[model samples]
Target: MSTTHQPTPATARPVGPPTKHQLAVMIWVAVFPTLTVLNLALGDWLGTLTPVVRTFVLATIAVPIVIYGLMPQLHKLRVRLLSRA
Candidate 1:
């Protein structure tokens, strides 16, 4: 009689790609309405501002906020992807 252990496949972990159902729900919940609202709202607000002011405001507020918000997550993802490759 013998005892043995086998490693599970990496895919066995409940990480990585979203399922089809999850992707569909994510699109409905996050993508569709946000895109429509952003386009409508930003179009109106940008139209109200002069082009130089619009550029300045967007650069001052939106760009920094977006970069700060996204950079850590993007760095983590980059490390993970590069390690995998």
Candidate 2:
């Protein structure tokens, strides 16, 4: 049996780390819509809490959503976009 190893294609290779600006843009894209929707949906309930408590709640909720949920999707999008370029 013969084994042949072909070079990896561009699409097969993993993308490098994002630049600072790219990371910032990705984070902003993920965070803005998330915070906006969360605020709109929870505004009435959150408004009843003190300012600090409301902020704390929002951050707690937003952090998980941004980190675990939206960020992964955003990273995938970034990779796809870069690959297409």
Candidate 3:
């Protein structure tokens, strides 16, 4: 008996990393809402910190949410949209 392998369909394939412009857009999309929420949630607490420290704190909170949370969902959306076309 012989077996033949079939190529995967485009819709079933994994998407690649974003291009530079796409990455810029993703960062813009992710960062804006992250910063807004962080500011609303911790504005008073962060006010006493130095500017650098405040920036660091905001990044620490935002990076994980963007990288692990928001980026993945956006990527899935991108894949879905592209597959539909």
| Least accurate 10 contiguous residues by lDDT in model 1 | 6-15
Give per-residue CA lDDT, model 1, range 1-85, as digits (tens).
Answer: 6665433565333345555775565445543454455546687787788989876755565445445654445445645654454
Give the per-residue Cα lDDT of candidate 1 at 29. 50
Q: Estimate candidate 3's RMSD in Å.
A: 6.5
For model 1, what is the C-alpha lDDT against the true structure?
0.55
lDDT of each: 0.55, 0.90, 0.86
**How high a TM-score does candidate 1 get?**
0.48
**C-alpha positional error of residue 20 in candidate 1 after TM-score superposition, expressed in Å:** 34
- Better structure of 2 and 3 per TM-score: 2
| lDDT: worst 10-residue window of model 2 | 4-13
Name the candidate that leads on lDDT.
2
CA-only RMSD, every prediction? 9.4, 5.6, 6.5
Instruction: Name model 1 segments beyond 4 Å from true.
Output: 1-40
For each candidate, how many residue pairs have backbone atoms clashing (under 3 Å)? 0, 0, 0
